[model samples]
Target: MSSEAPDPLQHIGAALFRPLGVEGVYARTALYEDLVERLTAFISRQRDRSAEILRFPPLMSREQLEKSGYLKSFPNLLGCVCALQGTEAEIRAAAERYEEGADWTRALAPADLVLSPAACYPVYPLVARRGAVPPDGLLFDVAADCFRREPSRSLDRLQSFRMREFVRIGPPEEILAFRQHWMERAQRLAAQLALPCRLDAASDPFFGRVGQVMAVSQLQQSLKFELLIPYYAGAKPTACMSFNYHRDQFGVIWGLKDEAGATAHTGCVAFGMDRLAVALFCVHGLELARWPGSVRAALAL
Candidate 1:
């Protein structure tokens, strides 16, 4: 007899996304679409500031990634592009081995690109090409389909997810203020949605002992914060939003300087669109109509 327990979230109708024979990749239903649309609309209205909007591709240059310092911190989660690199006969043999349930990826060679890990990563280098930032600084509304190697059954944690980020790049004081404003605004946004949430100092899920040290230092410096919401039964809340302050790291890496020739600081507020939608469902149940009137009006759903 099989002893595996059933997934507790299997019965979450309408709002639940179904995995497409993969551990983390999911197919969103109409209910999920409704949630994302409303969420996007609300963000657009609340974010009334002027900024450059950019939608980046899912894959980014591997060289750019290396320069971004992502490989140094998150080598485990990096998804490099690999493709079959052999003649017809070798490809046929590889296909047969794959059908026989053998390790077929051995024939693959790394490509020049890697799946993009964050929405704001690619923007830094591009901005650097334009030379020093202006006195007013730069604000970007960026969105991307990000990828990671995490494989989990939990609905909140996925290998592929959408991230919507409002990134600020400029002098220390301006960018810092931008992040602080969002931190406060994010809490109010959560309250408006009626989602029970809290802001907690956090760190990235770095790899290995060295990574642990980095994580600790990050927390100590208060460089990261997350908006956490209770999403599942008998479990701690999941982080649906992250606010990061990358002080001069990206600026130095990409040669992004302020008008005064000092390295520019960067800060971003990222929204986990999928996770936020699921949190709303978990908190209010699958029936959107039954949700609080204020919440419904806020989302305009």
Candidate 2:
């Protein structure tokens, strides 16, 4: 027998993901889905019970996205919905061009919606519509099928993935405290899963020269942190979770305010569901039954 170890990423791809002939997109196996469900349940249990649970579709209003400043900050990663417009003849022409292997997508125009880039993006607008937040603040558990335009062959970097976030909005002090609490809690959660990990200050993939400044500011302010775990041998660790402090950015755009009439500060603990599952499989081997007893018990698998 060969002395080399089995490739965990390859094993996961074969057993868990069915590729759709697209980089970063796959149809997941039942086993994978089951694992995700367990993860979701476990993570949900960690949230404050008073949190309002909200689930959103994969699409959000394009206008809202523009308003949220994602367009300016991460335009390269944004995916907009587009469709053939004009008369039936125009639509037929576009379809014919597509069949002819021409650039048919040029005929399509931007629709009113865009694929949601993050699970928490839609929550701000919804909460703003509900009027001012209560004095003690608000907590929300939100989940969605999120999308990004970046395509990679890496199994852990899916272009279309599920994200779950626990969002907090209120006074700056409370928001900061909430992020700190989750930052510590995330480490414990990772330990329970028996995954080797590290926490590091991180920055978003902002776009262009202006974005470079913003990214530096984000890091200097300690506004973003990521919990990274190894997804493959010899490769840099992948970020499986993020803690972000928006610091009135979303509040100002969405008109969210505290009961005292000040703009609310916002922060979220985001779980990259697919990435986390990949980390677990990478660290624990392909068989769930053979995983560490503590991890199995923690996930209740």
Using all chains and alpha carbons, the TM-scores for the candidates as numbered come to 0.93, 0.94
Model 1 gets an lDDT of 0.90
- 160-279 in candidate 1: lDDT tens per residue? 999999999988899889989999999999999999998999999888999999999999999999999987657698999999999999998999987789888899999999899888
Candidate 1 local Cα displacement, residue 134, angstroms? 0.6
lDDT of each: 0.90, 0.92
- Pull out the clashing pairs in model 1: none
TM-score of 1: 0.93
Which 10 successive residues of model 1 have the least lDDT summed?
A: 7-16
**Total backbone collisions for each predicted model:** 0, 0
- CA shift of 194, model 2, Å: 0.4
lDDT of 2 by residue, 127-203 (tens): 98999889988999999999999899778778999999999999999999999999999999999999888999999
Q: Which residue pairs in model 2 clash with each other?
A: none
